[model samples]
Target: MRWGEIIRRLVLIPPTLFGVAVIVFVLLRVVPGDPIAMMIPPGATPADIDRLRAFYGLDQPIPQQFVTWLGQALSGNFGRSISLHQRVFELVLARLPATLELALLATLIAVVLGVFAALIGVQLRGRRAEWIVDGGVGVLLAIPDFLWALILLLLFGVLIPWLPISGRIDPQIDIGFHSSFYLIESLLTGRFDVANALLHHMMLPALALALPFSALLARILKTSLAEAEDQDYAQIARARGFSRPEILLREVFPNALIPTVALGGVQITLLLGGTVLVERIFSYEGIGNMAIDAVINRDFPLIQGLILTFAALFIALNLAIDLVVTLLDPRLRHG
Candidate 1:
């Protein structure tokens, strides 16, 4: 990446995160819902509600409240969760690992399936093949992740009984460091049984996560490849007695990957935007779950913190993508 482009992206991240934090904070206040009313149990006296409001700083002016909360949050304080009755930071940290694991697992599955689809499209570039791939992508994209999760749960968990229905693991199983190795490492460690169980549990969610993302990546890759296929370099290379794979690999795929790299920023941003409903559907405890809880309970401070955290992540991921793009294609950085 050009040093300038890398620096530019780095510079842009903080302000963007700040903007998201402010927007979410203000918007939460704008929405209907008296935090005190939401927090207090029914039949509470007016005095009790007022005391609660004062305790949580709802009595303060909105600007004062936001600044005070923002200052504390920056110093690593997320305040108390009225619903969970725990420190918001601690609750978030506890639940974050499961969500991260889910995302990482899903991202891996998406990338692999997406690449596989791309390869298939490249190998079979005729009109019939294009139509088939297009139709598949369209259907997958149209189906929401939660619905897919429910269908898979019914098929694998209810009908087949081969995998547990939802939650990160079987409640009985202890998941410490021993649960770490999943694919090859597990096999090498003579933990094939555990590995199989892990994969079996993960497969449906992974498939659910993979389908929509793969559709997007495959569509992008297929289109890019199709365009690359017709470029003059490809024809020239083919005419010079180059092998088909050689021509495609050497002359096409590298160029095709540019669009993919460029769009990776939007994909990273989607992690926050797209994860909420799916996480709730699967009972997955990621930031989305945290956000949902905050919204339902009207935990203003916690909601702001969670949204800011997610926004920062989105900004950081986009910055990383831009940096990589600048490195791979310098034009992006200069412009």
Candidate 2:
């Protein structure tokens, strides 16, 4: 990528993210719910609620509320969660790792499945393969992540008893550096038995989240590959008596597949975004659930922080995609 394009990408993402954060800041206050009231004891008096509201600046006008939030946020004050009574930054930072782990693994799975399906579509050129792969991808993409999560839950959680019904690890086991150390320590110490159990627990939720994304990516890749196969370079390879695999890989795959890599860098954000529903169904502790709780209780500072954090993530990923695209496609690099 040229220096100019790199600079442009960096410029584009942050302002867009700031805009999203501002929208979230406005919308949360405008929603007309009072977190102070929600968090107050059931039999608390109106006087008490008013006191709490004023303490949190909830009694202020919307403009005042927004301006106060903007200043505090700019100064790195995340405030406390109204319902949880915890530092919002601490709470969210604690959960960020799990969400990042889930998103990363899910993206890896998506790339594998997507590229494989695309490869199959090219190698098996018949109408049947095309129909099966394309149609399946469509169906999978159309199905909601939570629906898939539930179905998998029923199958593994109830029917087979092969996976944990909820949560990320076994309750009885000791945790290590990562999540429940039960799994991580076990794996690190060459204990396949514990590692296997951990994998089983993660399998359903990961698959539920990954299936839709992978299917969509696969469909996009297949179309791109098919189009590439029809280009002059592919015909030239065929005329030269190139092997089928060689023509597909050496000639067609590189140009078509590189674009998918660029696209996947952007699509990684969607995997993180989709985790809201997925994590709730699985009862996983992550940023998505934290964000959900913030929204429910009208915790303005917490809400703004979560939205800003996610928006920053999205922008960073998008910038990475743009840079990678320019690097891979020389035309884009020069353009």
In model 2, what are the clashing residue pairs, if there are any?
175-181, 176-181
> Which residue ranges in model 1 land beyond 4 Å of their true spot?
177-198, 330-335
The local distance difference test score of each candidate is 0.74, 0.78
CA RMSD per model (angstroms): 3.2, 2.7
Residues 220-318, model 1: lDDT tens digits: 887888899899999999999998788778888888888886884467467446667667766654677678888888888778767776776777777
TM-score for each predicted model, relative to the true structure: 0.87, 0.89
Q: Model 1: how far is 245 from its true place, Å?
A: 2.6
Best by lDDT: 2
How far out, in Å, is residue 250 in model 2?
A: 2.1
- Residue 4, model 2: lDDT of 76
